[model samples]
Target: MNIPGELYFTKEHEWVRIEGDTGIVGITDYAQHSLGDVTFVELPKIGADVKQFQSLATIESVKAASDIFSPVSGKVAEANKKIEDDPALVNRSCYSEGWIAKIKMCEPSEKNNLMDAAAYKKFVERLEH
Candidate 1:
């Protein structure tokens, strides 16, 4: 339920912390909570091309496995290797250390397609009910 004010959110429950031409991406707090303890994270490879709303990676939790979609078109810049050994980092620190990938956005304007903190908080609240 922790919806940060600065990052953008997707309907599928991914978030991107926009940083200049780079975007740091991860599953939302709500998503990790819904998925339960994450057991695996299939990170996208560095240098791979990805499109907004496309499958960026996959995550497996005790409850179920789910796709992590990209929030913008980009080339993968870095994948968090720490999660490979301890996926629970996602459960422990999803907004910081547990971030899934860093992307070099090909189209920054695509961010407008995503929701801001206010909208996404409302969106998640609706889902909760």
Candidate 2:
């Protein structure tokens, strides 16, 4: 899987790329690979309040439907409309173009609860077994 070192990961397979106080969130590469060809994405509304580890969006794929959880609590600042139009972008480039939402962080300290890339890689390995 493509687990970028700079990002933080959740046990639920979401990732957060922190930029200042904003967190760019998305399903991990491992998540997209397991889900198969993505067909639809239901994103949170702008200004919606979300909680850490709570359901932020729902993604439907040929294999299954899965909830994308927030790795940090915040208000939804932006949702990627590109994924709404071409859901397959998730399967193509989950880390970049497939990012689901941008959150204006309510508590940056919540980041301490997340795993680093190395830990997440080990987590994914355990899942495979």
Candidate 3:
């Protein structure tokens, strides 16, 4: 799976790319693969207040539907409405155009609760065995 080194991760299989005080969030490559072809995404609402590890979104796939958790607390600054129209973007490019939301961080320090890519890499590996 493609786990970008710059991002932080949650055990729930989400990732967050920190940019300034904003965090762009999404599910990891491993997550998309496990879910099979994605059919829909319930994008978070803009201006919504979300807490760390809370249900930030819901994704439906050929295999199952799952709740995607936030990696940090914040207000939803933006939601990727593009995914609402074409959910396949999530399967095609989970790291970039597929990001779910951009959150205006309430506690940047909450990032510490998440795993670095290397640690998440090891975490996924452990799951494989």
Candidate 4:
């Protein structure tokens, strides 16, 4: 799994890359791998309000459909239209071009609830066993 050290992770397998008050969110590499080849991504509407740990988007793959939860509470600033047009981008490069949304954080401090790469790596290990 490509777990970038700078990003924060959630137990539900989403990642957040915070830049100032905006946070870029995506399903983790582990999540995309588990779901198999992605076929669709249902993006949240721009300007929509979302809460931490709540469902932010949905993804469908050949194997299953899964809800993507927000790693931090915020307003949906943007959704990656690339993934909408080519959901396979999720399987191709989940951490980069496949990112799902960008949120304008309501409270940056809520990021403290998330895990670092090391912690998330352990979390994924636990799930594998």
Question: Model 4 over residues 1-129: C-alpha lDDT tens digits?
Answer: 689999999999999999999999998989988899999999999999999999999999997888999999989999999998899999899899999999999998898899999999999999989
Each prediction's total of clashing residue pairs, residues at least 3 apart in sequence or on different chains, is 0, 0, 0, 0
RMSD of each: 0.6, 0.7, 0.6, 0.7
TM-score list, all predictions: 0.98, 0.98, 0.98, 0.97
lDDT of 3: 0.95
Candidate 2 per-residue C-alpha lDDT over 21-97 given as tens digits, one digit per residue, 9 for 90 to 100: 99999989999988999999999999999999999999999878889999999999999999999999988999999
Candidate lDDT values, in order? 0.95, 0.95, 0.95, 0.94
The positional error of residue 85 in candidate 3, measured at the CA in angstroms, is: 1.1
> On a 0 to 100 scale, what is the lDDT of residue 62 in model 3?
84
lDDT of 1 by residue, 58-104 (tens): 99998788899999899999999999999999999999999999999
With a 3 Å backbone cut-off (N, CA, C), the pairs that clash in candidate 3 are none
What clash pairs does model 2 have? none
Weakest lDDT window of 10 consecutive positions for candidate 1: 61-70
